[model samples]
Target: PAGDGKVTTPTGVTASKVTSGAVVLNWQPSTLTTGDGPIAYKVWSNGQLVATSMGTSVAVSSLLPGQNYTFSVQGYSGTHASAQSAPVSTTTAAAPAQKPVRSAYFDQWGIYENAYYPKNVDTSGAAGKLDVIHYAFANIDPTKLTCFEAVKASDSANESNPNAGDGAGDAYADYQSDYNSGTSVDGSADTWEQPLKGNFNQLRQLKAKYPNLRFTISIGGWTYSKYFSDAAATDASRKTFVSSCIDMFLKGNLPTGVAGDASGGAASAAGIFDGVDIDWEYPGSAGGHTGNHYSPADKQNYTLLLKEFRTQLDALGAAQGKRYILSAALPSGQDKIAQLETDKIGAYLDYADVMSYDMHGSWDAKGPTNHQDPLHDSPADPTTPIAPGTRKYNVDTTLAAYTTGLPEYGIPGGFPANKIVLGIPFYWRGWTGVPAGSNYGLYQSATGPTAAKPLSQEAGLAAWKELNPPAAQTHWDPVTESSWFYDGTNFWTGDTPQAVQARGAYAKSKGLGGLFAFSLENDDASGTMLNSMDGSLR
Candidate 1:
């Protein structure tokens, strides 16, 4: 078909399998002619004008499968059309289907209390809906066996002298004595020789009641973090500690000498833990005295520990014919950015829960009775220019610290979608000396600071409820998205329905695993805050 006008096709269309019903078409650009001003091209399929193009190539979609179609291109200038290019034939193939979405949840020490058990532990009725349960082992001390005895003694002593200056000290001493005694608190039997007993017992109970529930054992909190460095310092110690932990966690047995009794240890541990959770307050740095004080070797060794743990767990699962999960609790402050080896650790973990609370409050200079975790900007800093007193502990900053700082340190998935679990606080912090109507103020006590009114000075969920009832006064902080009330002399702060919903919404927007409140006991009796959280998440 010789014609005066020139014909051209889009450049770089190589023949390759894309999908069953679609085929890509490409060709080279046409040589510019002096008289042909801005040539236009027309694409044809089986002699039908499928597309008219001023430039090169287009993806042809929605074609009949197994049907052969002839494609050709023709150039045009104004009203005149050129001869068609050589016809190219292609057959349509079938397209591949998309993958289905999977769901997951974070259990932040949820299984610690057996809400589904005999005492009707949880008044909120959230146990049935929970998919994962986090079982905590925070008070375990490797140096002692009678820890429970000490705890019981401490409780008894505190009750004896309510006004004693060292009442708290007496309680701590009793706790240590119990740990050393290796005897149960009730004196009925021997204390558990392994670390996984109490938590595992609760987990076993929960799983028996809810067959579909999963359990993860979280280790290392603010108080027990001091031992991590010492345990991970040398290869021998690391191996010993890691081996003992896994043996106890996976098989319910203590590793060698560490266990007082070895015969039934493996079987007991295997019956409880479905996964291991690492809650190292901070690695490669010191936190509490219990922390091991990690060094440069810790950066690499931590990764090694996770890898070995994963490998061992996988092997155990294959042996037991069941799958096990691994996860960690990451630190929230910006200062922890440089300490962790993110990529290696992230590779081994199924997910990580960031403890996003304790961000601000009396810890800071000015007192503001607000939500410890806010979704809005920091209202206190005018130069930074954020929503005044908005949710200061919002998802934005938390996500940024993890995704940006972590990956920069060779840690992958810092911004991993659906792999992060946002933490919600069941309590609130309040301050005193706050100016009235100034959007921020202090939370004072009723007896003018000197009175032993209600509870201790420290703000806790239980204390707040007793001191300030909803009927007495309405507590509200628009900027911080929190609430508080004053009983004439004392100012108090506490969690409410509004704050809980805000936390759930933030988790939803970020595609996170879910939301986890610190302790279920902190919620109101009718499950007001818990119900609000569940509804918001759903």
Candidate 2:
């Protein structure tokens, strides 16, 4: 044996089992004895000493995620040291993106005037990250009491909507209207011969591009829920409703009379729709669109309706060899959710994304400005004068209403957290004519909602891309966890990027499924709100 007290160098140094923050290294033990006790191994990362081990393998911990590291191993026995093993390099894995599903509503009407299209989802890069895209406002046939597709031009000044019970929807936007190459998902113009030419075809293109994408035809939104009560009224009604929906959306049976060169009929839109999202504004509440039908039986019938959809969807899935999604756009208002059998309806849903925004809006026309989407209730809120001292009109209370029901509120606390997705709004809720108070307009009185926006934008309402109140006028409330704007006259409330990241953090912390927005059109041209959501929900 060599008298030099050094041990022979270890060979075959290797790095494996790498993660975002750690990596494991292994090597053949030094074969030659140093003529001193035993040998221990030293591990180095990026040329810095990091770990020591008695065995041939050592694991390096506390490394940065997605970092590139170069590691080497050395063995020593007593005062003697072996030459370093050959180094190996590796890049730590990137951290997992948001574990919860990220979903959003695609307002079909956004195409008419907002000029948003299914192609926007692709161009904005939302398609690559989204879990579900709920195509909003598929109508319920009032006469047949079933799901159907049709379009009727809207009348803003009219509250007594003639289309309230007429199975009215923008079918022209759904699959009938043509998308030119510039506005189409694949840069190809939709032709007359194509059975499906509009948003449905563009969605199909987006779907093909993103394998994980799911498109659900959302039936019974705020405007179209007028006939939901009739559709979900009884066992027979539920069966008829669920079957018609499955056939119309999942099975792609477009009504033949949609006004476009696109001839519509059986199987015209098959494979474009993954499932259905039930958005009956309220099962037994009076707060929906003015004439929406409601009955006390809606609570039980809501659960039964979900059950019927689940059963029928499962049966169809068995035949098609694919699982179809079934979700509901849940209400956030305590009173509205109270009308639902939260404990029961959850059993049949793949997801129940809470519409957590719109807690307060211009509807309270008289005064007392409010933050529409508070993550938590503010002690500073003036709502006590409006109603109870309780702070029940925020995001936390809404999520808890389902995932961990509030017993005091009659909500049963046991729905699975991972199945629930939180909703974020991409629009600002505002009001005007406020008296400049000590807090500007934090909760001051206002004569009414703001002036009506042009292009038919709702009065006192603005999309995320529209509002840019001055920095001097902006305010953030940490107690309520919200941000707002007030220039001593016009008061506005909405989700800033910081507020959005906070909500994403909230979703992860609560073990919830993910986050969604009320609309795709409300996002800034850069998709600021949507991008913030995608990056932070992890």
Candidate 3:
């Protein structure tokens, strides 16, 4: 031991990221010649040794929030401890508001043809307080196996020139059209010459006004999920599909011809979206669209696909210097849930958007006139056969199934409760020509819709706008915590404001992530349903 032989101290110590109860400390490793061994680091915080690491950075957690702390790192060679590195002082952030996520699925098609544009949304109500907005649909090309196509819809109004299918491009509604209104989030009109225009541009402006709102492009819905099984059939195919999605949404790679014109070019819509959502209807079974490819292998491949998506998204996020989210819209039916490897697949997703509403609908061969989106089970009979369209199906059961019924492959049991987000319906499933009774034909045998409601254009289905029954006609089922209305011949069943509040409260209580409705456009212009959801969380 020589007089000038004091171990050289580490330097440049800093706490780069400080959260409520964690800090990531970084410091230059020590450079010294001591008789001991290899160099190691001892992270000291407030005079207490918190961690030991061989690397330059260490994450320290369980620290008190809203408190000042000084951190220093000491280099150790063998048994000799060098003088501590320069201390870095930092104050932890206050504990964040533990508010559950409140999300809404916005349908892009509703903007133009339905006359329910973004400008018509009541920002003061539920629409304004949303945490996440999932823009409905980016379809996978069944043939090309690359790119997400826009919502190409037909103009049913023009009989002579019904818009022909043109490669699924809907730029005019997405980010092209100018919807000038007093309720513009920025109180400004689109220049009409901007590269990006419609609801996308409107969404960008809205996000600027409300910085915390997150928007994700939801890929796949009932009508457009014909290619998911094939896309995820093999690792190579999955990678191809995933890369294509990232390029289209995250990298803003627009398709040539139709969609390309709207996107302007690559990366044009890059920053507009925070992530991509997979809405692969039913993975191992039939989804919303006909001719969907499916197989028993889909169960396993589904998990692999999700893992790949997570891997690619994480890589992209790392390269882009930001976090990206990966989520999925999952089926609510227990039978359908069993078909997929959900316990494993869910691990890669941010949350499982359980389509808890459509548990029962007119798609059934026949129905007992049950509510489509009940909050809880009403019939207590265990032996009662719970048909696809029966009263036994409820939101509570769906939530429980995702969080506890299925074991996570040695993860004790059941899906992680926190990763489950209860999905509520924003519309009603209607049945016509029902026999009127004391319960007004609820749970009674009836002939399903004789014809589709003209406005909704879907047989046995009606949106909130098309199926608003009188207040006196509505009835509440206490056991199930659901509401239904039967105007003698027409039986409509869906969520009421009270039922939505009940479900939201249930989600909060169960430690679930949050709630996401099937759609925002289905709510009233006053944002009544959205407000009801807001009030429940409050």
Candidate lDDT values, in order: 0.48, 0.76, 0.69
Ranking of all candidate structures by their lDDT, best first: 2, 3, 1
- Give the distance in Å from residue 119's predicted Cα in candidate 3 to where it truly belongs: 2.9
Q: Which candidate's lDDT is highest?
A: 2
What is candidate 3's CA lDDT for residue 275? 76
Which regions of candidate 3 are displaced past 4 Å?
A: 1-95, 122-124, 154-167, 178-185, 191-193, 259-263, 380-392, 406-413
Span of 10 residues, lowest total lDDT, candidate 1: 167-176
| Per-residue alpha-carbon lDDT of candidate 3 for residues 1-538, written as tens digits (9 for 90 to 100) | 1113445677898877787655677777776664544555666665555444434665554455687778788776544567887789998888787677788888888864466665555353654688778888777776776655555663332323312222465666766566565535456655543344567656655544444566788887765566778888888999999998887776655553454443344334545567778888778785444456788898888889889989998886654334577888888766677676646776798887888887666665256677777676665423254444332456765665566663422122257888888887888987777887657777766676636766577777777766776899998888778888888888888888888888888888889888888788787767777888877877
lDDT of 1 by residue, 1-538 (tens): 3546443333343433434544455566554444544554555565445434333443343344566666776665544456677777777654344211111222222222322221122224655555455554433334421011112211211323322211111111111111211222111221333222232343343443444445665665554454565566666666666666665555544332222222122233343556777776677765323323557676677777677668777776554434577877776654453466654576788777777766655544344344455555544533222233222244465576566543333333344646777666655554555445443233321222222333333333233233435654645555556555554433445556766676677778767767665555444446565566677677
| Residue 225 lDDT in candidate 1 | 56
**On residues 1-538, what C-alpha lDDT tens digit does candidate 2 reach at each position?**
1224367877888874676655667789875452435455566555444545445654454345677778777766544567777779988787666467889999887887788888888888888778789988777777898877666754534556645435456778877787887998767776665456678777766754564577888987777787888888889988988999888877776777665444456555665677789998888988887777899999998889999999998887655434578999989887787788877877899988888888888889876888888888777677752122244588778777777787666777567888888888888888898887877788888888887665336787888777855678888888877888887789988888888898899888888899898888888667889999998775
Instruction: Evaluate residue 222 in candidate 3 and report its C-alpha lDDT on the 0 to 100 scale.
Output: 69
Clashes of 1: 55
Candidate 2 — which pairs collide? Answer: 151-169, 405-413
Compared with the true structure, the alpha-carbon lDDT of candidate 1 equals 0.48
